[model samples]
Target chain A: MNQTAMAENKAITISFPEELSEVQEMVRACIQCGTCSGSCPNEFAMDFTPRRLWRMVLMGQKDDIFKSKTFSLCSSCYYCTLRCPRGLPLTEAMAALKQIAAKDGLSKYKQSSLFYKSFLESVRRHGKVREMEFMTMYFTAMKSPFLPFRFAALGMRLMGKGKVHIQIPSKGEGKLKAIFRKVEEMEGR
Target chain B: MNYLYYPGCSLEGSALEYNLSTIAFMEAMGIELTEIEDWTCCGASAAESVSHLLSLALPARNLALAETMELDADLMIPCSACYLNLRNVAEKIKKEPDILNEINTVLKEDNLELKGDIQVRHLLDVVATDLGADSLAPKIRKSLDGLSIAPYYGCQCLRPYTVFDDPEKPTTMEPLINVTGARVHAWDMGGKCCGASHMNTKMDVGMELVAAILRAARGADAVVTVCPMCQMNLEAYQKKISATYGEDLSMTILYLPQLIGLAIGLSDKDLRLDLNLSITESFRNKLNNDCVK
Candidate 1:
């Protein structure tokens, strides 16, 4: 019910990271050896492999690369970086592209962003992630009812067994109030 | 060396077993993880995605708290998302003076600032680098002879910034797995995404991704991970993902600490087997009768 969550709930344009020089350097490191394609575990599943992504970036095809399904299929695993004979940071570039895609609202990463926001909100409130019950409830309310029941049941059992503390420790302690307020303001809540 | 430990949010929640086992296991390994006094959240996955400043500020607040605690050692974060957020802010502030100023100004209210001296390390990094494979190799109370473990890094720990080991095909975990007397299964899905938080929002998309990772881990007895989110996503969604893909990749998902505890002769109960989805009667029987003796 805090303002930050409200702002996140709003339909607003989000900005992506500026074109990173570091990412450019990483793109240039790709020697087009196709080793990245060979080492990519999900290459067969993805439309564009790591080799093609680097090639597209180098060819000034940022828009096409960003819009492709290849970026979404990236698991952020370091296989391409590990296999790149040129040692280009493929995963980082993927992350940058993902961030840019999210900012541009080109990809359907809003759910991913919401998940991250809700997690931080829970942490900020509880000083830990003891809100699985609430998280399950919130996510379910958001319409994803077939979520993981195992974790929710596990959380409840832990709470009942004194293994987990169900209450937020910061209750009445204004320590997080200022930080939470700043977060709210930054989120434009 | 002594270090301030940040278990992040998941250690205390869904992955509480990881926290419990980590504390016990680290004590056994002669390492001390002093929890920061009155520590706040590292903002995990969401804050960073929505607002860059929000992400930086969230972890910066925790960094400030660590500085205030005046801990002499680096901050050891066990959760991948928390580790990335803290490390990301630390790296960002150094390059972008304005980010440092903005985050520091926000921390000013609490009389805090992120002292870049506090080095952040994942628990895997601690076990691998700080503990050293040779040192750990000597302390294996029980050797896992027949157990096959797939070391899944789950993105945030090593990617986005090559701060740790090889980002692509990282095997920083291999040495730890090796030291634990277990076989590290060679798999391309070691660092693949386990759908992360999306498993909650987009079940179809998330389950497909989770299924792919599980397929890659087909032959392994268990998948050992360093992230709670990864563990949760893989373990909690296994049945659903399996049913969707019509494949029975009955893989037991565990945090590194839990696996370490098992290797060090801790009983399954001691490692909290009740929380795992794949720790069924068959798997438990397999552990007791087959390997890890």
Candidate 2:
């Protein structure tokens, strides 16, 4: 790998290319009026805040911004985008930044993302999100050995509470395979 | 009107009842849903969050399949996650031609292309627009009297674009609720995030988020949502929250279609009341049996 690529991989933070004129335009759209920061419920918890994230994107400090925990804390409620005086897509920008951060394998908040992956993949393969029985097994296997009892505890509790339904496969298995093929192709899997 | 339908992962699985009811409800409304020949996952919130290319490629592949079908009709996505992913891919492709080309190259093997011809509209948009409120109101044989519903738009369908309505405070489902004679509960968190995928990642954070939404939705009969992720999070995690917080607020969550189906005179059996986590028996009792039957 070349110096720049190697440097980028280890940079801990990342930014998109300058040719991504969309990011530039979006950054320009943000007047840094702090409406987003003001409206953001989690802004106080975030290190760099939304306004600073926008600024970093504009300044091409991609690596530094992507590494921050602020991007992960963006709940994507879109209060920022809706409240922004410039009508900038601040929430959308945060969502994009979160994706970029995940690309570099640096999601500080990954449990939900991991569940989303396993559950989604299961649905793609099974042609349905089966209720408790399959979901528990899948999640347990995925989060195995680390917190094995947590999975069992979750399952037993859900069952006791009657939250976990015994969902049947409403469709045939062939349909699932076809759906899986298409989804896997999309994921380049 | 005909549509190239993309069911996505949820309809086929966890939200199967939603899928069944949507198909039934749409057919009842005279909308033709031509299931795309071989559609795939839209990566939903996970793949895209983890891998951007996978997210775009997943939806792009479906879009390409719809294009190859040569269907000039709009592609109606019932699932909110699928709708968002498909719309995002279309929007991204317009900006990143190279990514589009690269995706098309992958589709070459499968004989598809992610052309942006197909208009991706949510099931709610079709029900509200295609079958006008007047049309829907008359069709509502079972008026949902005394039933108070909190219209939850969730985060996916409304935001990112002004395609349908205002994201921060959306009321797309309110008119439908009004038409059914079910009172729409005035709540501040209609378009708010319910801690969504966070429920799985950080259980406490997720439960707290759901708790906030539920607490805000106090005094409502039930919470109606469009997205499966939202429904799953709100419905499945409520018990955990109630246990953790020592509060009891069990709200019945239903897909917009399921609620509409009930109002338009479909039975609870047809709407799959069994799948829900809340007091569906009470909800079922609320539906006017004479009109629905």
True contacts kept of each: 0.43, 0.32
The prediction achieving the highest DockQ against the true structure is: 1
Candidate 1 stretches greater than 4 Å from native: A1-117, A127-130, A133-175, A183-189, B290-292
Say what the interface RMSD of candidate 1 is.
Answer: 4.0
- Report the lDDT tens digits of candidate 2 across residue range A1-65: 99756654676633435323456677686777888888775665578988888888788776677
Q: DockQ for all models, in order? A: 0.30, 0.27
Query: RMSDs, each prediction?
Result: 6.3, 6.0
- Which regions of candidate 2 are displaced past 4 Å? A1-30, A41-48, A55-67, A86-89, A107-189, B94-99, B288-293
| Residue pairs of candidate 2 with colliding backbone atoms | A13-A63, A14-A62, A14-A63, A15-A62, A112-B201, A128-B13, A129-B13, A129-B14, B64-B113, B64-B114
Please give each candidate's TM-score.
0.77, 0.80
Q: Give per-residue lDDT, candidate 1, residue B66.
A: 83
Candidate 1: lDDT of B247? 77
Worst ten in a row by lDDT for model 1 chain A: A12-21
